[model samples]
Target chain A: MYFLAIGLIYLAVGGDPAGIVALLMASGLGGLIAGFAWHFGRRYGTRVEDLQDSDAPDATGVVGVYPTASLRPIALAFGTTLLVLGVPIGSWMSMIGAAIVASQVLLLVHDTDD
Target chain B: MTTIDRKPSAPTVTLGGDDPNHLVSIDSVIGPSGQEGTGLPTTLVGWLTTTNHKALGVAYFVASLTFLAIGGGLAGIIRAELTSPGQQVVSEQVYNQVFTIHGSVMVFLFAVPFGFGLANYIMPLQIGAPDLAFPRLNAFSFWLYVIGGAVMLFGFAADGGAAPFGWFAYPPLSGASGSPGLGADMWIVAIILTGTSGTLTAVNVIATITMLRTPGMTLFRMPILTWNLLVTAFMVLVVFPVLSGALLMLLADRQFGTKFYVPTDGGSPILWQHLFWFFGHPEVYIVALPFFGVVTEIFPVFARRPVFGYKGLIFATLTIGALSTSVWAHHMFVTGEVVVTFFALTSSLIAIPTGVKVFNWMGSMYGGAITFEAPMKFAIGFLVTFVVGGVTGVMLASPTLDFQLSDSFFVVAHFHYVMGGTVVIALFAGIYFWWPKVTGRMLSERLATWHFWLLMIGFNMTFFFMHLLGREGMPRRVPDYEPISNWELWNQLATAGYVILLISMVPFLIAVVKSLRGPANAGADPWNAYSLEWATTSPPVEHNFEWIPPIRSERPVFDFRWINHDDVGAPGVAEAWMAREGLDDRWLPLAGPVAADVADDANAASSADSDVG
Candidate 1:
């Protein structure tokens, strides 16, 4: 509706048919969104705004899970990057970076806990 | 070091069956936000080891800011060298390295990661999810970027100075024969890491947006900022792979024996251009879309109205995203290998969507109570400069125009207007608008306004004249030029402008320091903003929202305000909204009143059917 409105205004002011056509295309896009929204709502029930006047329900609990952090991935990625960097530098640096990457990747997959 | 497993701490989620009418308390088991995730350390080590999205966001912010400082210093050196007609400040080799690193750091180190910082922090919160879908993947992505960037820049200390080739690092020049040093190799490897990180980040973002949206928050109902990031993330997935492949091919040529880009060995250096710009054009938008999202998110709030044409903005965003992929060849216009008509038209057509956004912003401000605060000022600056930048861009889309302006200061002015003008300035807008939300204190509006004004003056003075210099055929990437052609005057002017731009950062730095020490009194809805992030406290708690506000509409808070509003487009909307919602001071978790409405309609239909029976 907004696009069509703008298109109308553009037509009234100047004979830019291109302007009108572009906006109409945009309006079609707007229609596409509304169409998607309708389908989405029918598929899954619409969640509404929280009204303070309402009462609490029977269920209430939180099981917020924070994944435990591990350094293996970081170590492996960094080591591999260094090994790549080392290829043009020297064989020794390449060997060291490769060893670190190998050990870290093994630790990342094989060693469950860190 | 404490050993820990990646398991949900007993119960993995906070399940709430609160009556669809009441707010569900969301503050149950999610430990304090900004704190480490389950089984992660709370100490500094947690910052390094944790997969929590918020921590990663903060780390990206800090790292990127440091890179900005480095990049900004390099810009100062470049300007200083150009202030006069001679290479007085630094050697030519040093100058080349400085500019190369400046462009690389700004794009790879600062801009992209800056988006990552803001998105990783805010995207999950907007979707009402705890964190990104793959927490470990997010952590690994950040590490890849950091390690890659660090090794790449460490080329400064290598046998030869850093990679002196431009950020593009075009082949033949960048091939083993031309660049025999380790610096170029380091640059190649670093880009690979950055591209890999990009893929990883995009995957996690796409997953979170697709699967983790709060119940009832349909695709259309998601905030425009999230929408922008969604498009940006998808672009990341599509474009990064191409660049990574190209870089690896370049790496293969640079490292083991290969002649992929070697001109003598049945290779064409021009092949690199096709591969690079294919990703490069989208990369420009990748840096841009978030800031566009920022301006969209902020414009409506300060204008004291719902965003003008929400659906229009989303479509425009999508349109820009789609066209961005096809327009890559436009950048190769002067290369003569491009289909001029196809690219020129597509490039010109992009103006329609971009212009639609400009019109939407103008319409938003029409007859509205306008506040010329810091964020708004920067946003206005962005609008003016982006239009100018965009107009010039269209002119260049014409192959004839591009042939003249290619590699000139005009191109520099155009890009800087978009990048420095829109991207960086929009980042400033995000910082100021979200400042109070991030730190529980208001930034001094007085200092913020001063910073905005200086930035405008300094920024324009620096680049606008470059259009003239470019017109005069002043080629780029030169350290010194002959004092003839009156180019010295323009160079001096541009250099002065760069200086002013540099000085403009001081007030902002001061304001940041003062804000940190000032007060902790900014409320959740400082701007009375419409998005979900404002539904929580200034600095959100462990679980972000104590109760996840119901996904009522795209503007949840706005919908909450205008619930009883039968009369739209009235000034008393905010006042009246506060009166109704403020009656009960406690904010419960948001739930649907819509479901009830639907149920009521169904009930009425059933009753009518029964009566007829």
Candidate 2:
């Protein structure tokens, strides 16, 4: 909302198209955050953080399940390095990087299913 | 000579219900025994794949420090070249590349990432969260940073020998006609990747601060460091994307014959400035705020008082973040195109919140028992130098003044005072303060004293003279200068100061090396601190805390310690109880003799209440 208002103001003040586009993009990001917050608030209801009379222990006991370990980050990083390097190097490197990235994404989804 | 055990003390209280799945008993969470089934492997592969925030935080520190060494080495070369006059060290082209790479490495790789590193390690502990909201994404961000930084350095090995167009890479200067090289292209690609990493990390930080704060640690109740990081993350999320976009456009202009910055071809070079500074200005606050948070945390701890006007500090931080977005055009004041008055106004407004913070830090120390530990010493150095920097910043904010001083050594001095003097000094303070909690060992105080004094003297000597040099019309980013007036003298002094600065790091490195090789003498609550991090072991367990004390105040650990031991009427009794409980004597009021006074005041208050009844 802040970005939206700023964008509108910039547009009113004869700002450049690029500047306006940047402002609008920021507004879109703001909207995404708002949406995320709305979804989370609805799903989780009132958290202990929101309560006035809550103790520290009230919010304890496994906040959420997190991964113990995974090789995907390093693998994905290797793929990204290649993908970015391909821009300066060649198209073949990009192809190989894209394949690895695709595989990592599939594996991530498959792991989530388990 | 007492070796502080890293093992957690047994749980003394229990809470929540008896349901096995939902059990929140203190015993359930507090010890290595409880973590038997959930231990992360202690192997190289484990480190590569680990999504633990603490481990990733350590990685950030190591990578950032490595980059700092590289950047500092580049700075040494630049200073060495400029020490005398005409191109004494490197060619003009090599000089440009050297300074550009130095600026890029320092800002992007070292300063920003160091803050994130501190935040990653400490913020979760401060907020009582086990890890960041997105643990996997956190690891991914770290790896991306590593790759991006590696690629950035790899630019020097490229065909054209790195980007010579400066860190900002403004306009036609950065175009194919200006810097037609694979190095520039690599620089762009590296920045885009790192910017993406920063954006993703910002999202992770924001989500963690917002959602993962433990019960009673409300947004306002959070420690100032976490609050600063939360605001810093928001700024990062908004601005880093702009930088990434700008870099992408620059790449397009360079490679694809785009006219984005080609003014003759219906494009404006000023557009790039608009986008860059929009990110760049906030980027200043993004780096500085976390360090400011570090000092804010330090002042209260060393002064042995709660942060004065804590809520006001929060509002001040928020105000700074909000105003920072509007003040980006102040960097372009000399361009003669921006609304100089409005930009100037927004930029000046930042000083108010910053002043509030400075005063609040003073207020925190006023009329309080204070200690002169290395962290506090460095923090005091930060206060003095940062004020000087802040005043200069306000002076620079004025369009009339900026028109004269823009691109001069004055600008260099002002930012270095803030970034190098303030941020880096505060970073040292934080490192000294938290070394125990991070490593489960104590850094040498004797060495810390030498490090602090050398840094303070060296930093001031280096940058303070640049103000006069700049005022005398010496422009920055120059490889060599004419010996007109006192330019040569000031340059020589600055170079000399840089040597002192270089020497200062020696003691700090030794301290770190010695501490790591030494025993774990810094027991939990080494400084008898206020925050949650100190409530746990020196180096916390795999899951951070075994048991979090009830968060009745921002100073949860302080409240827990004093309140639990309130039954002891005197210092002797307190000592007896500590000894009976096998507590290290070092934990007994390392802040000062003030703890005994506080205990007396508490006893008096309780007895007076009984008399009234």
Candidate number with greatest lDDT: 2
How accurately is candidate 2 docked according to DockQ? 0.35
What is the TM-score (0 to 1) of candidate 1?
A: 0.81
Summarize candidate 1's per-residue lDDT along B1-613 as a digit string, tens digits: 2221111221222322333333223223222343332222469877788777777887888888888889989988988898788779999988988889899999998998999887888887776665677777788889999999897789898778888888988888888877778888888888888888888898788777865665545677778889999989877865677687778888778878688788789876767776777678879889988888888888888888778888999999888876775566677777676566666777888889989988998888877788877788888888888888989988887878988899999999998888887777888888888877777688888988889988889999999988988999988888988887868999888889888888899999999898888878777666767777776566765445554443446776655434334454323333433332322212222223343343355457768988999
> lDDT by residue for model 2 over B1-613, one digit each (tens)?
0111122345333222343223232223333333332223478998898888889998899899999999999999999998998888999888889989999999999999998897789999998877788888888888988899888888889998899988999878889899988888888888888888888899999988887776667677789999999889988988898898888888888877889999999989999999998899989999999998999999998998888999999999998987787778888888887777667877998999999999999999998899999899999999999999999999999989999999999999998998986678998999999989888899899999999999999999999999999999999999988989999999999999999999999999999999999997677767868888886666777767655655656777666556434432112322333232322111111111243444455457768988999
lDDT of 2 by residue, A1-114 (tens): 767776777677666576677778877876787788899889999877766445543332233456767888878877887887787678899899898888887786676522
Best by DockQ: 2
| DockQ of every candidate structure | 0.13, 0.35
User: Residue B261 in model 2: shift from native, Å?
Assistant: 1.1
Global CA lDDT computed for model 1: 0.73
Quick one: best TM-score, which candidate? 2
Error of 1 at B351 (Å): 1.5
